[model samples]
Target: MRPPFPTPTAEDIRLVSAQLGRLARDVIGIPARCVCGAPTVVATAPRLADGTPFPTLYYLTHPAATAAISELEATQVMNEFSQVLAEDEAMQAAYLLAHETYIADRESILLVPELEGISAGGMPVRVKCLHALAGHSLSVGPGINPIGDLALARCSWTPTVCQCLVYDA
Candidate 1:
């Protein structure tokens, strides 16, 4: 579920492609896997093979999980999370650290000047996308991203049991 997660195998790439309905590009590692061994979160290159500045380091690839997170976002929960972030000082600090951590992790792979100081989601000061934040929490394990951890807690899906179903999208 963390750094020890194995590198993406051919089947892993295939599953991720199926999950995304497109080719999984520049996936350096499978950061998190489903209970059935499918990739739930993929650690992609900061830049694409075509040399695009891709800032999203950890991407949620599971259809079920993505749907669940999307559902939460649809409920206008990001506003509530953003409000909470504005009120909680410790959470703000942790979230800033999470932004720094995300940058560090991506920089560890390869430094992209265009992506400097940029982390996925609305981290540090806002909660824009639960998918990106929850993906970050799932990738690094909790405590590093408090809002992410909270989003994961509120979502209906869980990584414990297998949620692998017919991914139509």
Candidate 2:
């Protein structure tokens, strides 16, 4: 069993979102107009012990500015992470292992990033982060608008699933 919750504060989300946005602007070279178009902001998201955000399911409200941030930042984050995996063989293997586990246990699993670990109590643990879909239209929850269903569809991944398994309990 896991701790069943996320630990990132609203402030942490703000910090990471800001940092990531800066990374996207500086390192990734996405235009400020595009990056800042929707005014990126942070919210409580899940991550793993090594400080990687969880890629699990996320909820979005209709036409929320967060969706734009979610779309751009999510892709940027994954691309950045992909580079890391390309540079480190161990990281690549770890990513594969995590991906395998995720596919094998897709039912109980939501999002599965490599940062998860076992706690001192022998339960699973992960850093808290937000989730967002990149490419297609989805009928997620109530009142979540269809702003970027096409963007989500354009992502390399289909099914476009995202969620965070941890809870505040």
Model 2's alpha-carbon lDDT is 0.31
Q: Candidate 2, residues 83-164: lDDT per residue as tens digits?
A: 5546766554543443333233222333444534421111112112223322101322111212223334344423323322
The superposed Cα distance between candidate 2 and the true structure at residue 126, in angstroms, equals: 21
Whole-model alpha-carbon lDDT for candidate 1: 0.87
TM-score computed on alpha carbons, candidate 2: 0.25
lDDT of 1 by residue, 1-169 (tens): 4443467888888888889999889998998888788889999888899999999988998988899999889989998999889998988899999999988888988899999889989876778888889999999998888988988899889989898975532
Q: What ranges in model 2 sit over 4 Å off? A: 1-75, 107-169
Q: What TM-score would each prediction reach against the true structure?
A: 0.94, 0.25
* Global lDDT scores for all candidate models: 0.87, 0.31
